[model samples]
Target: MARHVARPDPRAHWVLLLLGLVTLLAALSFHGLVSAVGGGSGPDQAPASPAPRAVTTGGPVLRLDGPTPVSRRLPARTLALTFDDGPDPRWTPQILDVLRRHHAHATFFVVGSRVDEHPELVRRILAEGHEIGSHTFTHVDLTAAPGWRAGAELSWTRNAIAGVTGREVTLFRPPFSSTTAAMTEAQYEALRNAAGSGHVAVLADRDAKDWQRPGVPAIVKAATPQGGAGAVVLMHDGGGDRGQTVAALDQLLTRLGTQGYTFTTVSAGIGAPDSMVTATTGARLSGTALRWAQTGADWLTSAMNLLLGVALVLGVVRLAVQVACAQRHVRRVRRPRRRLPEVVAPVSVIVPAYNEAANIAATVRSLVASAYPALEVIVVDDGSSDGTADIVERMRLRGVRVIRQANAGKPAALNTGIRAARADLLVLVDGDTVFQPDTVYRLVQGFADPTVGAISGNTKVANRRRLLGRWQHLEYVIGFNLDRRMYDVLECMPTIPGAIGAFRREVLFAVGGVPADTLAEDTDLTMKVLRAGWRVVYEEGAIAWTEAPSSLRQLWRQRYRWCYGTMQAMWKHRHALREPGAGGKLGRRGLPYLAVFQIVLPLAAPAVDVFALYGLLFLPWSQLALAWLGLLLLQAGTAAYALRLDRERFGPLWTLPLQQLVYRQVMYLVVVQSVVTAVVGNRLRWQRMVRTGEAAALVGGAPAR
Candidate 1:
């Protein structure tokens, strides 16, 4: 008996990994690492008490900590140019170029997140003899945020600038703030809080309103101070398109120079010390680490988006191909054909049993009840502790025989049955499967063509009254059978499926019988036959009903084995890629398709789900909901079409959406575990599902005896 050995569950490790990824993405969004899509912060509109007359009428630079506020005006013939919402990669450099050409200096109020992204720009600003100030991390409105958040915003921005330039800034600018006269009470409180931390508030004397992207001429007029009163001018170097800002800066500099106004940094205009001061060693190191961490987060976000886009495109293409090929296959099979001799070859049915006493009686009975005249059934019981062989023997059905053997596993028992059989055509089936009376007869019809070597029969779920069973039924109809039809049309059918498939006796022996190397013996055998120049095809008219796992644990084990075995078989036959004829077609077409849709897609599915959650939480809900609904409708439409093709009722498909939440996740994890096991080179034994004998009852037979 192939018993399962206890091993550490890898689910905890994968779950933790997925959670970590989601957390990182959420953190990135919260911090605003990516640029905003629409525009800069809107103008502040909340009503509040006006500032004191002395402060409002005072110069742009103010020291508000004392009982009486102290302020300073810019020197005569001087203009203090300060840019906010930077260091943008696109517009900042152009503004810097204009300033460099005019030999002018300005203070850049940098957002901490943007500084993390373009640290080199911050360094460039410092190296070029300009000034830097804190614009608050993420460009958040300090007046609207909590006091703690406002404090952290200022601290984070200072650290970011210190990381790049080895300096800390004493000057601060609140997001969406204007001239002192326009300041609200909340804004003043925020400024007072910053003053307590040694930050001097830097309000603008002139509002260029350049972020509005008015014509270049309008921006220039708004920025030019009245009568060279030595005023502080505000503008933008970030936000949306700054073409007007850049053009206005160049023209403003030239036009203002003719008016005898010299542009300089904020501190220089006020005759104060430079706003930037050298930072302590500890701050610099921690800030540098923060910079690198944010950079990595940005890269990860971009890579994930690219991967999701690619997966979406591939998924759509796969669906389109499946529908097209399935339709083609239907037309080809239904077209009228010339009359030919019916195939009545004697057939041997092989049933490999391991602890399958619960299902053996019905399996044997179904075989004996086949309508075909020349049929022999061989039940090979492989060391079953349960009385599997005895159950079949007690039935005493005509043309049925039972052979007992030690537990050498499924492939060895299958080979034993083949050698003892007395017919030229063979049908392979699992012990838990129940067949219709005409299944074997219809299965052999493909043998009428001399070149056809094997046939794959359609497999259905026999215990689909429960939700789990219904989910499996949907998968069988949409995911499996539909793909089989497509594969048949493409002439690259990979596996004939052990639940129900037919093979030629000679073809089996020529390909060295059932392969023992992989757990999926049927797939291994089918590939061997294809490599030997025999065409394997699907016989949809022949159907077998098999028991699907009722519990999640059982489903996980079954799917893990299947996925791992298929991967092994694909690897074992990898040389077919270089071979000529049918082998090449299987390699070039079938293997890649399986790798992308089966292996790679499942591996990527969890990450996609994580991203979808991220979108729901941080992104626009309406857009995300519409996108999810569109995908659901596409899947439901495909499932409906597949069910129609299989002559199944549409009632099972109502559970399809629910399956995405539960069953689909289980399948994804199965692929994950299988891939990890394969990569680690661990050996997986045969996992037998406990049979309920429900399949027999579905076909009008008695339950387990």
Candidate 2:
């Protein structure tokens, strides 16, 4: 049973994150490029002279240099009405409905920007038998605008219009120009410039000044024809609240019909075929590029939304479930726990030391000062160059043994200590931890059931002077202790921290004496004991104070090792899930909880942050802020409850809110990098943390007051 087998390699969930980040960046880049390309021509295009209009006092004043057709003539009793600057989401639909209700066909000069924003409206414009044409891309004055900008203003809109509608737009309307006779120097120059390009310029014969939002009657009077040869009336369906425009259009159409006049599209009224792009400009490539760009952007946006939704639901549900279970355990733990047997057997305490000279004395002294009558202390120094073994040997304390060996690892050192011990009950302690006098006695009492293989002791951080230390202290209580309550109640407690835990000797021996393959040997061994048919429980009364990492770098490294190692152990023991019976409850109950709360939830936490940023930029920031505060309050409540249950003071929890802002994200990044490294086959070496001799001071001589 002590023989070990090879474990499975890693899974590549890390790729999902890599791909997710890459694709998200790609989507953002695509959007930016589309914006630049849609709204601008190349910045290097040459400047051009001001556009010239047909102003000569000649017959017909026909502008031959212009690319678009100039038409002011029409049949009798026929009105050619044209709408420009459209595809406005709010007003466009109302205009479309009015056109549909009145059975009218009018040309809409759609702005490229609005088309991109509301492509559905552009489709509706085309679907409703209306002619679509360019409105200078962004309503810029083409006559004074640079030739390159003007060129792109015309061409990009045509490309985009085609991109969305699969139809070419050839009709052009110079922005800020009203009619053939009523034109400014720049407007006529713009007409000449646009005609130099391949677009037909359409000028309205009548201006309603609807954009000024003059009263409905004024707009009607401006647009109402006064018994003339067919006229081209200009009204707007977009750019602002077109309620008055819609009303004015309805009134003018009723008045015109009563006067026996018919409405037609601009192209029809101008004696030209409907405008459509029949030739490709520059977009006729493999077609895959645009499709891929669109698909990737769409997918990334959808994924972000999905992540936000899932993270919100899972975070809330897990918090609720864990809190409810913890409360139940609190009520049950208040009931008197079972007492250890009358025969308080002899016990062996193992202190694994590796370059721990700064703190070994406190560990040995705490164990030696134990109230239990029968106790033996073994200090296993795994080749500590810091004179750790020498310190223990120089103490010359009775029944204290020192074993020196090459630097293997904590697991190997522990196995050596187990072999040297002569007692059936064992306690394992890290060299930096200081235990209470009665902790060992309190710890072993859980094994009174005979079936209980191991008991986990409550480990608290002794160093809490720094902000990081305070955050860790809060985490130890709220995250670790509260979680242990639920795990203990479930009978599937997985880890017996190396800081302070007692195990029955035979159970440890049966489970292969701490395999060195995993970083979290303690967790690996505990799961082995469970699979080997042994029960594990948490004993909070057995308390020890250990030092936490002092800096963010140290904290990151410490957590990386722990998280990566725990993942390894979880993967290693995954088979236990298939086994039936009460002993496999660790696999059935404990594993799922760890997989979710520890692994999956932490991995998905970035979604909450990402979504928070997304909401800040695009969604309702006030609601997002409220949701964040609610989660923080929920965490505060949990921390308070755990502290009360542990008999710990709540002063450190003042930093809890700050922890959410900074410390929590650091831990999340640690988990993310750890998972990425683990999946990518990056092996992590075991390194010792630099501990300050501060552990003995904060918890010196006895338990904290």
Candidate 2 Cα misplacement greater than 4 A, ranges: 1-104, 110-129, 134-157, 170-255, 271-275, 279-281, 284-296, 338-343, 699-705
RMSD of each candidate? 3.6, 7.3
What is residue 449's positional error in candidate 1, in angstroms?
A: 1.5
Residue-level lDDT of model 2, residues 390-485, one tens digit each, is: 999999999899999998889999999999999999999999999888888888887778778888999988888788888998899988887887
Q: TM-score, each model?
A: 0.92, 0.79
Task: Give one digit per residue, the lDDT tens place, for model 1 in 276-319.
Answer: 88998877887788787777767766777899999989989999
Local distance difference test, per candidate? Answer: 0.86, 0.77
Report the number of the highest-TM-score candidate.
1
User: Global lDDT for candidate 1?
Assistant: 0.86
- Could you tally the backbone clashes for each prediction? 0, 8
